[model samples]
Target: MNKEWFNSRAKINYFDKGYLVICAVLSVIEQQSPLNSTYR
Candidate 1:
């Protein structure tokens, strides 16, 4: 019910989305090139 709580929750959601996006990108890269070391 507080302003600060809402702000932090928004930030956390943004961070989680960013993390998932990165994971998806990595998965695609792995699929394209399974021997690539870029993700490692």
Candidate 2:
């Protein structure tokens, strides 16, 4: 019910989405390059 709590929740959701997106992009890049796969 509090405005501050709601704002924090929204921020967390945004960060979660951003993190997923980064992971997806990194995976795509790794798949495209054989060198990157060796690091993992």
Candidate 3:
């Protein structure tokens, strides 16, 4: 039971890190788009 709990927690942490990375990338794209539009 303890092992199963640890595995689930690790999975959650992995997914959370992935989600954070995706969010960071999306935010960078979003920030760049406005600058691009203004320059054009």
Candidate 4:
């Protein structure tokens, strides 16, 4: 439970959550956008 270790872990967790949110938003946009049909 060193301060540096905790900070690194928190950063990793924050990036993971941010990545998931971006993915979800992209998926939602893909589903709604008419341009996505070309990729399918």
- Lowest lDDT 10-residue stretch of candidate 1: 31-40
Q: Which stretches of candidate 3 lie over 4 Å from their true place?
A: 34-40
lDDT value, residue 20 of candidate 4: 100
Give the whole-model CA lDDT for all candidates, comma-separated.
0.86, 0.89, 0.87, 0.88
lDDT of 3 at 17: 100
lDDT of 4 by residue, 1-40 (tens): 6999999999999999999999997898798767577556
lDDT of 1 at 39: 53
- What is candidate 3's TM-score against the reference? 0.76
Candidate 4 weakest ten by summed lDDT: 31-40
What tens-digit string does per-residue lDDT give for candidate 1 at 1-40? 6999999999999999999999998778888765557557
Alpha carbon deviation, residue 1, candidate 2 (Å): 7.3
- Our model 2 lands, by Cα RMSD against the true structure, at 2.5
Task: Estimate the TM-score for candidate 1.
Answer: 0.74
TM-scores of the models, in the given order? 0.74, 0.76, 0.76, 0.73
User: Which prediction has the highest TM-score against the true structure?
Assistant: 3
Error of 2 at 16 (Å): 0.4
Compared with the true structure, the alpha-carbon lDDT of candidate 3 equals: 0.87
